[model samples]
Target chain A: MEMKSFLIIGMGSFGHHLCRSLAENECEIMVVDKDSEAVEDVLPLGVSGRVGDCTNIDVLRSFSIDLFDACFVCMGTNFKNSLQIASFLKELGAKKVYAKADEDIQAKFLKRNGADVVIYPEKNVAEQIAIAASSDNIFDCIPFVEDYYIAEIRPMERWLGRTVVDVNFRARYNLNIVAVKQGENVIPIPGPNYVFNEDEHIMVLGHINDIRRVAY
Target chain B: MEMKSFLIIGMGSFGHHLCRSLAENECEIMVVDKDSEAVEDVLPLGVSGRVGDCTNIDVLRSFSIDLFDACFVCMGTNFKNSLQIASFLKELGAKKVYAKADEDIQAKFLKRNGADVVIYPEKNVAEQIAIAASSDNIFDCIPFVEDYYIAEIRPMERWLGRTVVDVNFRARYNLNIVAVKQGENVIPIPGPNYVFNEDEHIMVLGHINDIRRVAY
Candidate 1:
């Protein structure tokens, strides 16, 4: 398979994690940051590090920025530099550019300045922590729609030997079974012929109220 | 906080993981399985274990089933036993019961037998593995509608300084920025005014075509 190239423009904790994760997956990574220490820290992770201000078009071009399939603008505090970098990356012909914003204003600016996607770390982290604290049975929760979510719930005693068609889940509980997890295996969009067994995880989609009623 | 009690009626690998995870979060766990070895294996995790047939009404009632906030029926095979257990749990006045199904037929049977929810483990696990194998940028992906999905995308350089209103993203890419993740935090339904920054993960909703186009 052809490898995807990624340029990460920050060497903070989050950036380091992303680089390591991507590298583990065998993706080629290029990292840019003004901090020499940060650049050096991630070098052993197989990332090509360039010590330069991300806002400077010359510095970015020096790294052959156009060759990267995607670029991440991860400078959290310096809004101006981050915005300048995003605009330049777009102008330089990068296929996609994602930036991180500290607040709503900064995110809006990034989007207006040509950023393809914007991220807010504070809010995201809080939600994850909250969910983790709220329920022990939830392995993972992903929002599916407005006021609706999909969650991977550890199977409880009452669900064994059940099938999707028999539960009348959609009608009775207003939740939909999207998939099931058994050990390391998964069954997606299972047909009516599927069966329930012990030690399984159910992937369900529905409003929070409906999901809460059934999942617990 | 008041500790919640959960009864997990299987001692398989999935059950073991669930018990450990729940115990780590400080919930009281009770495990029931016909397999003596399975029960013994998870005993060190501090879960209460019983080596008896979970399908037997006498066995279920012996545990004072009403005290449990929820019960998980996790037997994979032996559909008859699974169905009997679900029914018995409900009849004994358990508030909620979840079951695991090895196939669609079993899942249907469990539901009809009074299981509140049924899980298909093979289905959920496969989808998670597939997505994990396919993309490093996306930490997780959940389908919302037939063609639309929500994904947590790792921030890339081109998105810094952007806001929802500034990009007209829904119009431009047919994608919605639903939430943002930064570090270990999550922001649900972030307003349009939210800003993008570095080192943040983004929760986005859009058609698969659009999600693929923007997430990368």
Candidate 2:
């Protein structure tokens, strides 16, 4: 694999996590934060850091920002600082810029200014939590798309004796039973004749709406 | 709905977002951060705040932390401090504790120390980005389970004229189409007779492993 480099503009939660993830991916990462203490905290991760204000063009230029493969502007909440840093990264000709945004307005600012991708990590996590909260019966809720979810759900008592073919779950629930876990074993792609085991935990692929509609 | 109160330590991206989401759910919230600016920035949201070190048990005690229904520790990458704060939250009798981690080791520390839930936001984003990176044709990837993803992709040429019933996507690909977006129209549940439109964006739910097998 070819080596890549990144300049992370903050040491906040989102930026710190992204830096670690990129480091695990074997990228050369350099982090910057106005607080030298924050910079010092990340030093053990094998990533270099320096106390610098990313919003200043000179501070960014000192690090040769344009030469890095990408620049992560992770100051999501501060509108002025984030926008300034994003614009400067693009002006310096960074190959790609990824920014963190706290809201749709911030995302718009990042996109219009220069970000290649703008992510809202908080929103994503909250949405997942909301799904789990709403689907109380489901042990876990994994959002797939607008309405679809991949979830670990217990079959309603009425569903225990039916076989896959008898219910035609695909048509009835707009879902597929991808796997079933009976205690320690995972049954992937169970045959059509497979019965809904009362003691097993099934991985159901369907709309969250349909899953909510099931009468427990 | 029964309203709950929460104490959020570290007003970084993750905590700030979660705090906002919980506030929307009608929960009373109080936030803390060493950075006074961060605490000040979030005050407009109607949540109260105090500038203090979460690792300091006395500081936490001053806030009457145990009275809150739950607590969120969002100091990602600060292993020692995060562990201390999480342990202190439980010792103070907070009903639930959610902490943020940057890696497996940190997550383990949080779990062992007292965190009821430990989330890795960077890992979540990287997995989503990796799916998008690997499947160049897929526009979006939302993870549902260990191996499943909800993805949006352009229909293959062969699928353009076919109806859903004739294709039997679930059997053929271990996937289901939950919704489709054509221009401004979003079809939440396309009927069996629904034909794949060339201009539409189809939201497919399936195992990421199976989605990877698609020719497109």
Candidate 3:
């Protein structure tokens, strides 16, 4: 795959982590923030840097933001500034603009203003983590969509000493195991003959309802 | 499932959302925050409340915190205080301690200090959103583990008009579709003969490599 170019506006936690992940993937990143210290800290991480207020259209124009494939406005605490920044990014002809919000209402506002995607980091994490904690054997819950979930679930007492095929998981429970997580290692596309064990974690995909039936 | 009790240490965005989810799931909730206003907002969501610093062991003792099944520390931007609170919760005999961290270093620190699970809301959301933005067909990406991903993807030109059995997605691509999201409706465990439409998003589970093979 070709490298992606990203313009990250703000050096908050969301922007910082995004830059780090994109850098690890060999993407070219240009980061802007009002805090000089924040921009300086990320400079050594192979990202180009600038220090300026993101709400100003002139600052975005000076950076030639239109050249980037996507831009992220991660001003978590500043709703007004983030909205203005999102609108300005769209006006600058950026291909895609994503913004971070503290709550659901703010997400709707960002989406209405011009953000291609409005993200709520806190809500997303809380929902995933909360769902995981609620279930007895689910170590984590990742939503593929509203109906389907990718979950790390331990083998139930009834499922012990059984192979994946023996359980008739797909037909009986409307679920399928894609991988086995042994300790910290992930074994993907495990064979149907793979046996279930007490200590291992199985990663499965299914309707959230079917997942709960086996997970609990 | 029987009723589960949760004690939320801080009423920030993450805690507030988690509390709301737990309440909606019919769990008993006890929420505490130094800022009374933050606590007040979540009161209508069917949660009991207290106003105090969870970092102080005495404040926690007053609440009889050991009775709760789990506790969540959502004190954003206060690493030291959050870590201190996690330690206090464990010391008081809380079964599990979950914490929110802004960075990897903080996650390590929280884990060492009594947090059984350290969640990085920003990093988790950023990584998912970035992967979604990078791929043309991927509407969303959820990591099941380090190697496996569950992604909502639109069918590419090669996949258009093909039936599930015809494409042999499971055998050829090492992937399986769990659901089909058409407009606002979700069709879970979609039939094998279901036809692919350009407007619908199919949620599939596979290793990251396989997801990318189909994503682009």
Candidate 4:
């Protein structure tokens, strides 16, 4: 496996988290921020840090922005700073730039400024939570594609004690049981003989219309 | 579908997003915050809003907290206020309570203080971006179950022009192609005879180890 390298600009809550996650992935990372304290906070992650404002072309250039595999501009709530840094990184020839945005307007501007992708952390989480909150049977749900959702849901009362083959789940409900959660463990791609239990939660893939019909 | 009712306290970024999402879900929502400007910001969503300090039990009681199907405490960085509101909501007999936290310690305290669920929006999004950044083939991914991810990935060069049955995807890769992304549309649960094209992205469900092996 090849070790990827990354340059992350900013050290706000989102930036700090991105740094930690990249470190866990064992990627070679260089973090930058104007605040000396912010730079110091991520030192324990075993990554290099520079206490300098990335909005300055010279400061951004000094890091050889083009050399990193990808660059991330993570300024929380500061659309101006994020845009400036993202544009500078692209101007300096950074390969792939990811920028954080709070909403659609910021996301559009960031993309226009040369961001390869815009991450909407709060919006995504909120949507996921909203789906879970709207339904009593769904424990958690993440948007899969279009109207489809990958939902962790309680088994229907009729499904209890019935084997997967016996229920013909895919044909009858138009849903795929991807995994079964029993206590602390998740059994992925269970065999056809696997029986639905009252205490277990099943992770299934299906359209929202179908899921709602069966879930209730 | 039954209309769900929500009481969201604290009009921060997450709170606003949640309110917007719940409104889209057609749920009855009531928003609250100490800042009148924050309260005014969400009035356009067709939901009721109140500017009051929820940490004060008297102000919280005025809302008839027990009437809502669920309550959300969404104070950004104000752990004290969130804990106070969460505890007060549970005491007021709110059916369910969800609270937002930035880290594990805050999450633990919120859970202990009567929050039925704790959300880590920043952490979840950061981890998701980290995975995408670390891999060259994965466009986006979300954690599905233990060590498993539902990833939108570029199809391998060799798989182009092959039918789903021709490749025997599930048996060969131990990965399930849940959906096919063709342009802006996603075809969910594609038929066995569906052909793989170079321009399309496939959303697959599999373990990290299996994904890593095949994605490259």
Candidate 5:
């Protein structure tokens, strides 16, 4: 695979993390921050680093934004700075722009201004935790598509000893047991003969209504 | 389902969102914060609201902590306050406690202090976005269990017009097409004969390596 170049602005917690993750994936990165310490922190990641206030168009212009495959505006709390940088990146001909927003309202404004994608971390995580908390058996839930969800849940008593084929999972529960979580090990796409164990958590995919019917 | 009551402390963005989500799910909730305006913001959701510094044991004691099914500490930035409140909740015999943290280090400290679950919102979202951004075809990816993941991707050219059974998806690809996304509609658990289309995004469940092989 070819290496992708990324230009990252802001070195707050979110920016620091995004830089580290992209670097681990072996992407070529250039990090920028107003504070010298912030820019210095990610320099060891072996990418280019710059110290400048991104809110200033002159500082942004020095970077030659069009060279990077994508530009990330990762100011965690400064909505105004993030918005301004996102717009500047677009105006400078960055191929793609990703911005971080704290909530839905901020996401809309960021998209309208310049961001191709707005990542709302807090709101998404809050909703995920709430779904897990509100349920009796589900440990975690990820929304799939529309009303469908992928959920991690404890097996019901009746399913403890039965194999996937024996129980006819899809016909009986309207859910697919995509994987089985046994302690720290995850067995993906378990065979039809895979037996259900009491101590294990089953990762299933189905409509929300079907999941509720079985999880409850 | 029987109504479950929850106690939420710290009305930061995460807390505000958690409170609103739980209320929408019809769970009884009591929201607390040091700022009256923060508490008042969630009151319209018909939840009990209070303004008090949770770091004080006296203020926490007044809430009858044991009566709550679960307690959530939603302080966004103050690790000290969140650590203290989490320990206090456990000492007061709160059944379950959930706390939010920015990264792995804080998550560890929060869990050690008495949080039953630590929600690391920013880190989780950052990793997720990195996965999507790093790939060429994958639009989004969710870590399911161990090395398995649920990914949304544009169907391969070879897959268009071929039915699941015709391609022998499970045997040939070692992946499961759990759902098909066509525009806004998601057809979950599509039948074995479901045909792949060019304009549609397929949601597949597979090991990281298998997903990478197909996605790239």
Candidate 6:
């Protein structure tokens, strides 16, 4: 298979993680960072690492930016350097360019100036933490809509051996059970006759209130 | 402030992670698992541990299910047992119940049986991984529509010194810059004057095709 090529602008924590993930998945990676030590640290990871300023056009041109399938601006701190790199990538005719912005103003500028995608890692992590904190029983919460969510919740003690027909859950809670994950195995949308087990993880979907009610 | 209460039915990897995360946030937790060892393992983590069959009605009633704010039905392997638990929770008038289902049929059954939410862990994780792999520059991708997505892309070299107005990104790429997130900080909906730097993450909204065009 032809491996996809990627250019990562920063070699910070997020960048390092992304690089490792992609590399493990067989993607060809080219990394750039201003810090020589950072580049050296990742050299053995088998990715093409360059110690150079990502904001410099000459440094980018040296790598033949057009050959890359995509570019990831992983710089998470300085807003100015991010924009410069984004503009440079677009002007170079790279197929796609992604940048990380620290502030709303920087994000807007990147978008308006040709950055294809901008990410906010801190907000996403915080939201995940907040959601986990707010609901006591919810193991993991994924939003389906503003009011609706899919959550992994611990089963209440009362639900030990009753069948679906016995509960008439639809009429009462207005929720949906999507699937069940058991250990490494997955049961795709179990049948009505399926019996509940003690070590199973049930996947559910419904309104926040309804889910919270069952979760609590 | 009154802390919320939670009940975790299964003591698997997901359950363990959930319990630890919630407990860290100061939520009260009750853990129920068939394996005595599993319950004992997490006892020191500050969670109430109970070794009992989740499918038992007597066990369900003994937990004072009414007091729990929500419940997580983590049992996914045994569909029959999961269904029983879902119905039991509903019968007990637990405010909300969440389950992890491996199959679509299981989800349907859990929903029909009063489970407020159903989750498919494999499916969710698979989709997340797929998105991350599809785009070289995209570190994260959130789907807003079937054809549209919000992606976080790293900046490229060319865009280092330009402003939003100078680039005219919207007219060129049909992408929206929503926000930027720096390390531990978030700037929502940045404006034109905002500048881009090398070390920032920006949030952009656009169709997948457009996003790909700009990001890569």
Predicted structure 1: lDDT = 0.70
**Candidate 1 C-alpha lDDT tens digits along B107-204:** 78889997987755443432332343347577777644454567788655665788766766657876666567776665654656777787788777
**Candidate 5 lDDT, B84-140, residue by residue in tens:** 999999999999999888778889998999999888877777777777788889988
Question: Which residue pairs does candidate 3 place in steric collision?
Answer: none
- Per-chain TM-score of chain A in candidate 3 equals 0.92
Docking level of model 1: incorrect
How are the candidates ranked when ordered by TM-score, highest leading? Answer: 5, 4, 3, 2, 6, 1
Q: B128, model 2: CA deviation in Å?
A: 0.8
Best by TM-score: 5
Binned by DockQ into CAPRI classes (incorrect, acceptable, medium, high), candidate 5 is medium
iRMS (Å) per candidate: 12.2, 5.2, 2.6, 2.0, 1.8, 10.9
Q: Model 1 over residues A39-136: C-alpha lDDT tens digits? A: 99889987788898877788878776678777888776578988999999988888778787755688899999968877554333323322443476
Q: Once model 5 is optimally superposed onto the true structure by TM-score, how far is the C-alpha of residue B64 displaced, in angstroms?
A: 1.5
Q: Model 1 misses residue B53 by how many Å?
A: 52
Which residue segments of model 1 deviate by more than 4 Å?
Answer: A135-139, A144-148, A154-163, A181-201, B1-216
Residues B44-161, candidate 4: write the lDDT tens digits: 9999999898888999899888899999999887789889889999999999999999887889999999999899999988988888889888887878865788888898888889
Clashing pairs in 5: none
Model 5 alpha-carbon miss at residue B212, Å: 2.0
Error of 4 at A95 (Å): 1.2
Q: Against the true structure, whose lDDT is highest?
A: 4
Candidate 6 lDDT tens digits, B1-216? 479888989876456656766786678899999999989988998888989997989999998887887788876467899889989988988888877675567889999997897755434333343356666577666644345555777655566667666777667767766556575454544567667767877666667677767766
- Model 4: CA > 4 A from native: A157-174, A189-200, B154-177, B180-202
Q: lDDT per prediction?
A: 0.70, 0.75, 0.84, 0.88, 0.86, 0.70
lDDT of 2 by residue, B1-216 (tens): 355677888877677777776766556778999999999988888888999997889998887767877788887657899999999988988778888887778889899999998877667876676355334467777775556666777787788889887888777877777678786455554657889879998877677667866624
Clashing pairs in model 2, backbone N/Cα/C closer than 3 A: none
Worst 10 residues of 6 chain B by lDDT: B121-130
- Model 3's CAPRI class is acceptable
Candidate 2 lDDT, A2-89, residue by residue in tens: 5568888888766776776567656688899999998998788899999988777999889887788778888755788888888988
